[model samples]
Target chain A: MAKTRVPAIEGWFTTGDEPALVGSRGKETGSYFFPKSVAFSRNPAAPAEKLEEVALGRRGRIWSFTTNYYPPPEPYVAPDPFVPYTIVAVELPEEQMVVLGQLAEGADPAALKVGAEVELVLGTLYEDDEHEYEVWKWRPV
Target chain B: MTDVAILGVGMHPWGKWGRNFVDYGVAAAQAALADAGMEWRDIQFVSGADTIRNGYPGYVSGATFAQALGWQGAPVASSYAACASGATALNAARAQILAGLCDVALVVGADTTPKGFLAPTAGERRDDPDWLRFRLLGATNPAYFGLYARRRMELYGATPGDFARVKVKNARHGLTNPNARYRKEVTEDDVLGSPVVADPLHLLEICATSDGGAAVVIASTDFAKSRGTKAPARIAAISTVTPTYPNTVIEMPNFATDSSAGVKPPETTFRDSIAAKAYDEAGLGPDDLDVAEVYDLSTALELDWYENIGLCKAGEAEKLLNDGDTTLGGRIPVNTSGGLACFGEAVPAQALAQVCELTWQLRGEAGERQAEGAKVGLTINQGLFGHGSSVIVIR
Candidate 1:
């Protein structure tokens, strides 16, 4: 049932049983990954996981966040003059892990709080003339 | 370790240089060499506080300055300990001179920081502690400063006005300092009006990062006398120490503080510990200090430093500051050279610049800001990670 046709962390996670993987030498250890793509785990020697398998889907509570009013250094161009956005840590329950992602548009930091619920959505970070990179974004739920 | 004398010290005016950091470093080094009545080739070693070089060799400033000063073939060492980099460089140069490894050594630090919040390195690497803190907590450096500022207000009964008073006092002193970044007086009302960067801290309450440099020429006592330098400022002690385990309090850019699982933290704070070690090595108490240069990253932190350096009993810093004990003409002058608050943060170079100010104060050459007949001076700086540095200079 855990497979759900989604990508799973091979040799790490299995349904109804704790995920086990070979760690340091021949020793074996249990590891847990959340949203599988966001690789939050207790053990260092865990197998790569898929995002769909472990994802605590969509909207989560805002753990904490800060607005980058100031321009970031290098490679990141602001949306013209000042493109301010909140970098929020959202707590996902399915994996019981907190994930950090940029806040979506129309989300005002002044209205945000410690436990504010947020929704994860696919977003574009920035696009130069040559290429584009997909980024994860969060907005008020 | 061998005793070393601060034979010469110099600095360039700190501000928006809009130029390369190497140029400022070379200028400061030239001034120091000139002040020492020695040529660049006369120096035996060079140590610089390293800065992140954007693809330039100057990132490792020791070699950068060595090459800038025309390859003196002297031993060079580069150190980075956040704000404490300057003092760490001083300690390294002093060690070389004391070990008899080199008779004369030069310590220099400089940085041309890009404006605004210093962001973490670009990449998806989660293994780096610096990166993890930013990604997980969104805890900027100013956030930690705000935490300390808030704690000060809660514990010490310090008012927001009191923090502004530190800026006023330091800016007033900076008016006499040609090299200070801000040489004008500031008012408490002005501080109140400044926009908030963090909760309790206004724009003016926090120090701005700048591009600047400072250099000091340190030599063995014998070397100083031979060079016709008399009554040189002597470095009596240096503390380059780290904290004990179980550091519960959250430092800057850290997502979660220590869990306190293994062992208890020290009774004294990390800052206080650095000062205590310096005093022990120098065989002097806080009372012996005529002047001091402290890391005043924020106005509130300056008051905290007074307590950490044993200027007064804990919680008495506010009272002492209110009573003008830390002003230029007060009992124990702190930041007489206008500190980081007035001088601006130059990262790795700031701590070395603190000692330079101390050397001047100890030699009774601080002009208008001179602590009357000052005999002993101290400078303190705390770096990121687990590093800190303090130096006691006497004449």
Candidate 2:
């Protein structure tokens, strides 16, 4: 049997071959929300809809990028003997939302530029002896 | 417009003093009272900007400050809006006088931040956006600032040289500020030589977390007149606007922005909307102002505010900086108190400190950093979590 694959946060992205982020789409108005936009709609006039789950685009353009020089404060588990990592803000043309994710292994600020194309990929957040926590990461394409 | 007179303003010099926040608050409160030539007993109401990172006293700052100053049975309220905490406290005090609930109100905001990127209060709850941003994406404050900086360079042709100039200019002004945390002059070389905290922004380009306090005493115009406090600067407007819905920009503490597909976005950005509301309330335009104090959390963010505050047209901030338009003795000197770049961010106290600088300038008392003939001045800052603040003061 395959080992248990867990996400750091639930209902945010998928684990399938297609590998896409999970978001919410309003039934009344065609709007997308990442991390589930259940409560309210941006349109004040249109009543909020019963939100439905939708898959976000797999490829997007980099809106901006930066490197985290210092170790981030906790709840963020870093690799021991910490090394700096780059974060990318990607704008999905289909969803019209900018989502942030850590850059893939060996890809960082020095290699990335604004408007660069990127594809979503699964990366390890961190792991204990029992389980590996899977999180979405961005890779240069 | 409901007018509130700021009869006094004072600050506890910003630095890493390693003292309890209560001491800073009390000292600043006493200084403000003395500046107004009033007593603590005269303060009918006290509103405090809260400090969440600290212990019990931070949450109940109004009562804590009142108790520290020897309580005089004054009504108290506390506000928390991240960095806008100070401005929110000022707005609360102004509201009391304008509502006829109090003749005079004292506002105090103080903080002693730990050195590092400001993190959320300790907890494990995944529901907190502030914590989630840090935990999941590793989004430190500088990351967001870096994102904005990179975008600015791409869109507006702003250069690292432009960013370095802002630090140099602010440091020069900070040399004149007794209360500023870092007062030494820094050249562009100094900025370029600093280590990179975020891409396109160096260590010297960013403000640090500091320990400081600031206070203001506001009274109704009638009360000031009765007390013979002549020629005082009057706060014509205080704007604490929330972001309009469909906020498309990706700001701190949020993993994603509102998708534009749901609704047509507003014409103005959330930051620009803050100044528009203040300008409307004060019946003044940007051109009417003599000086401005903007939140310069990062050097690039300062240039961004130049457009947001209507100092120049969009994508034209670089020109303004290069032309010496935002420096002292230029057209509309910005950050005349050296801004967060020099003072370092004391969180709750930072916004109030901006007003203190403006107050001194309006009084022609800002000895070295004074904007010549400063008749009208504005202070603006956007705290994390959608808190926007702007206050207009005129002599």
How well is each residue in A23-82 modelled by candidate 1, as lDDT tens digits? 111112222233232433223333332222332346667655656544445434456776
TM-score for all predictions? 0.77, 0.97
Which 10-residue window of candidate 2 chain A scores lowest in summed lDDT? A41-50
Candidate 2 per-residue lDDT over residues A1-141, each given as its tens digit: 444678988878899786888988888777888777767755564765667888889999999888877787887888888878888999999778899898987665677878999999988788777778888999999
- DockQ per model, Cα: 0.08, 0.77
lDDT, candidate 2, B1-395, per-residue tens: 58889989999999999999888888998899999999999899999999998998899999999999997899999999989999899999888888999999999999988978888778897889888888888899999998999999999888999999999999998897989889999999999999988788899998999999999999999999999988899998888998976788899889888887767778998999999999999999999989999999999999999999999999999999999998999999999999999899988998899899999999999998889999999999998889999999999
**How would you class the docking of model 1?**
incorrect
Query: Clashing residue pairs in candidate 1, if any?
Result: A35-A54, A35-A55, B2-B98
Give the CAPRI rating of model 2. medium
Model 1: chain B TM-score vs. truth?
0.97
After superposition, candidate 1 runs with Cα above 4 Å error: A1-141
